[model samples]
Target chain A: MGAVKQTLSLAVEQHARDRLARESEAQLHGMWVVIPAYNEGKMVGEVVANLVTLGLQVVVVDDGSADNTQAVAKSAGAIVLRHVTNRGQGAALQTGIDFVLGQKASVVVTFDADGQHSAEDIPALVATVRDEGADVALGSRFLGKMHGAGLGRTIFLRLSTFVSNRLSGLPLTDSHCGIRAISASALRDLRITQDGMAHASQLLYSIARHRLSWKEVPVTIRYTEYSRAKGQNVTQSLRILFDYFFHRSRGGQP
Target chain B: MIIRAVFLVLLALLTFYVFIQRRRLPFNLIVMSLIVVAAVAFILRPEMSDPIANYLGVGTGADLITYLIQVGLIFATVHYYTKFSTLQSEMTKVVRELALLQHKVERLTETEEQTGVGRDRGRAAS
Candidate 1:
């Protein structure tokens, strides 16, 4: 019994050491931050710089932005991929994911190019995938806090979440939070085909259809004026619905 | 009579062009040809559609034709929209491949330069 306790204690100490070393290990290893940007030059550089300081490789898919998004992202230490034409956020995300996966990224964390999501949440989300065995760790603002979400935005987000849950048949508190960590295995099974804002819904639906294990880690979203200017509104829900019913292929394949 | 001649001529040209593009066009050739044939039949013998129109509870052959054209237009619209969306999705894939390829080449060149410099530095140190 004493020997068993000693072995367990040593295992706990080794786990602590691993957890402490994991940041640099994950950085040198295959943990990648994929930021899909289009006309987000004003914010992407800062976002990329912050993520890079965290010691993770950042890949930014510049979706044919009219601005200097490609230059700014590259200058900020991100491997910039260029789409000669704007293919929307979904396509950009898929592009970045494919690029990073080709680089043999073991885990990919997608963050918005707009400066809304907190960089601090990445470690915990990565832990959920690395240690807790979750195929995906979705960042949920409602599970944590929304710093500047107005009543209208908040209500719309909740409604969107409800609709997404109904459509995808997943009990998620959030649908389009724009920050999630997906294991390389889970990402290999899913592909983002919806080229518009509908990709968010498509992602949730794909997750459900693929039956990947997912956990919602609490993450904060700050609704800055910039983010609000760039974000989705309630009226866009009509277009999103059309995209869901019309754009999403049968069975969520590809 | 002049308007009838103009319509017939235009219809003839349309059918000719459709056959020329039958294999290349993204629409259904058989369906379009059948519609063109039906249109020519109605244009040539207007009274023939009256009986069919009356049986379908439409007021006149002209009204029935108008409704049928609307339905056909709607169907074509739906068909084209889906095709457009598919094209866009396929284009996304092509664009993604091009982007990834560009990135790969750029990285390869960067590494080549870095390694070249590394070799020089190692020689200098030795």
Candidate 2:
């Protein structure tokens, strides 16, 4: 009887896994994940492969990387878009968003290509947009958990969050998480013009400006040695602030 | 007197340059002209800036001239920075368009290859 019970549990687990996979596949139909990669040749392939395994459509905008990021991402099964010259992360994201939206995607999710974000957290973000009817679902690392975040990085992210919250008035805990789910309709009203890391804050300001409904969802970020190395530093944060204020002063348009 | 004449000539050259660049520069033409005129007044009279300087809390015409030049420089810097940023954005848009167009071409080629191969297979099989 005990042996039979173990067999039944194994079959039940397998059935449950299959059902969840099918549900996620159905939910991810008409969904496209946009990953803006700049010289992330070492990591983008694995990241793209993981998403592809999850039955998610992915587009990697290779922002004029000197490395072989284009080839790696292509081999990993991403629809690759290559900018002829180096544009900032914002520009790359815009390119991917435009391409996928043109492909008639119903939902668009901007994900980081540096392998900091986990693929498992993506479904909840999409669900918030699709099922909860939120225009934008922002991934908040503070709301969830993050691993290997040193004290300095933690302080920087929190400080930037405070500043972005004051500037955007959206009451966000983590304003710079790269994972977000934006419905195609909300995207129609949105345009990212910051062309740099400052795009994070600009996206929030945009949400506030358009009066779009947004929900902050818990998402985990693994700050591995690589991501920690490529992560934003104090100088970059200062540049982001300068870009935000300067762009705001210029009326936030090109 | 020679110094003043040199200054006037230099200002004339700058004004001419600004006029020629009127099409490209974001500087307000009228504002730039006004600045050139004021600069000429300061260089010629050398004391006309005193009353204005006093009203503005600047000590003397020479000091006021320095401050005004600095302010003008700052404004020019800001204008050029904005212009540069706009040009960068325009370039980014062009690059983005090129990338998208390239992707479309690739997709078309891919589709053609698959269909062409499938058609050949069907004919061969028959």
Candidate 3:
């Protein structure tokens, strides 16, 4: 009986040590942040610099920018990937995701490079995925301090969220939030093929389709004059709706 | 009468062109030949369609032809729309592949440069 107790104690001690080692190792594991940019050379440099300052690995996919977005992002210490043509945001994001997955990123975050997203919010997104056991941590503007969006824009966003929720069957406050963090395993199971603004809704559809564990975290969205001028407007909402339904009518192949 | 003869001649020429390209354009030949035969029958005998239209319960022969043309145009529109969408999807795929290839090449070059610099440092240390 003493021998059995001793052997069990030894195995328990070994298991405890292994768990501690894993926890410590996880503390040092960094995440990959992918910023899909299109002619945002004016702001991509600052965005990349801010993310790099936060000690996160950043990759900027310049979606065939007519300007010098690639050069600016690279000079800001970000890995620069360029599309041959303007394949839109969805294609740019998929390119960045595949590249980072190849590099073995533990967690992946999709960030916008239009200077609307705050780098400080990235940690919450990453922590939600890391510590909270969530497959996807989506950032919501409505849940956070939403500044600079007018009443018209706010109503449009809410209407879009309603439509997206109905289509995806998931109650999400903001469906078009450009900031989101996902685990490597969840990303491996996802295939984003919308190749346009409709990707935001498509992501929600995929989350519901794959039954991924998701949680919403409040994140600040700084909509500056420059960002607002360059950002998508009400017209794009219509286009996005059309694209989503068209993709669905085609058996959701996109 | 002269107009009818002119149409008949034009149809004959079209038939000849279709026959010459029959192997390469079998479906087009059959469709065009049918159209020509129908036009010839309509011009030669305007009263022939009355029985067919009556049998189909259409108001008149002219109305029946109009309805048939409308249906054909609608079908063509649907077919072209589907084709356009497929092409668009294919274009998106091609653009994505090209972007990925560009990224891969950049990564490969960066890796090669780093390795080359590492080799230089090792030689100096040795």
Candidate 4:
């Protein structure tokens, strides 16, 4: 039994090394890091700086923020796109993805402007997409273990995971994590019609409809005081779930 | 009382004609069913019409029921018309955005073609 366990461990280590090598090649081809900001002027600059240090072409889409988010992000050496009006997060993400595709980026990575996502974990997501031959790599907070999540947030994540898994048949442990990396082909095919929180659910449905290969990797999510306060409460979460079903029933895009 | 029966029969015939002419079989069938029920009730127990009206809070005969039904149908028609108007406005916004994006793409393609021509001339000169 001990020898068998050692053999499995060795295989896992070899697989990890192979994945790292593939990610290095993807990085050399240039990955566009897209941060969708909406009134996150305070945190957007720091997020852009961190991504720039990681050698990724950073593009920050300011979704008609009522603050200086665009100016700060531009000052931080990131390309900034400003919306004329407040189109929701999904629209902002679509704009950034369109711009990145125009720039001929090989891989596009999405990060939240709230600073909850760590730029250091980007390579792991890119590696998962490249090595496993997956179209998209999603960062999962509840995959291996829960880290630094409050009780309320933990319950919300579990309920969302349950609903998403049942609906998409993907068995995802985290459905709403903003940290994800998609290949250029997948990004080009994605059509985001929903403008609000329902866009997240729409993306998963699109992936399933297209029969795209995807995987979830464990990653740490930082919840600062400001982020926790601004994050969706239980009431908002239920509303988003109801909106997803209502829109689906109306024959609207996910 | 005989005059009222004749009037109801004419109304039922007109409704059936409208349904058939419009090809609205489902709505026609529903209205026809209601007319049949009203006709049977009138024929079976004509004296009970006043009591049925009072039960419906109409305080009158079948005439009051006809008035109430007409008002309700009109209200529903107006409500649906307003809903259709709202949907038209939303569609206009979506079409405008699509047109803008298409124009942007066209300009970008034109610039690329122009650059390609310049590069070809430079290569030939070299």
Among all candidates shown, the one with the greatest TM-score: 1
lDDT preference between candidates 2 and 4, better one? 2
Question: For each model, chain A TM-score?
Answer: 0.89, 0.90, 0.88, 0.86
Q: List the residue pairs that clash in candidate 1.
A: none
Across residues B42-87, which tens digit of lDDT does each residue of candidate 1 receive? Answer: 8888888999999999999999999998998999999999788878
Residue-by-residue lDDT tens digits, candidate 2, A10-80: 99999999999888778778999999999999999999999999889999999999999999999999999
Q: Give the TM-score of candidate 4.
A: 0.65
Query: How far is each candidate from the true structure, as Cα RMSD in Å?
Result: 7.4, 6.0, 9.1, 12.2
The docking quality of candidate 1, as DockQ, is: 0.73
Q: What is the lDDT of residue A229 in candidate 4?
A: 74
Clash count, one per candidate:
0, 0, 0, 0
Candidate 3 interface RMSD after superposing interface residues: 1.6
Q: Candidate 2: global Cα-lDDT?
A: 0.92
Q: Residue A127's C-alpha lDDT in candidate 1?
A: 88
Residue-wise C-alpha lDDT for candidate 4, range A173-192, written one tens digit per residue: 89988899999999766767
Q: What is candidate 1's lDDT per residue for A165-195, written digit by digit as tens?
A: 9999999898889999999999987788888
Candidate 1, which CAPRI tier? medium
Higher-lDDT candidate of 3 and 4: 3
TM-score of chain A of 1: 0.89
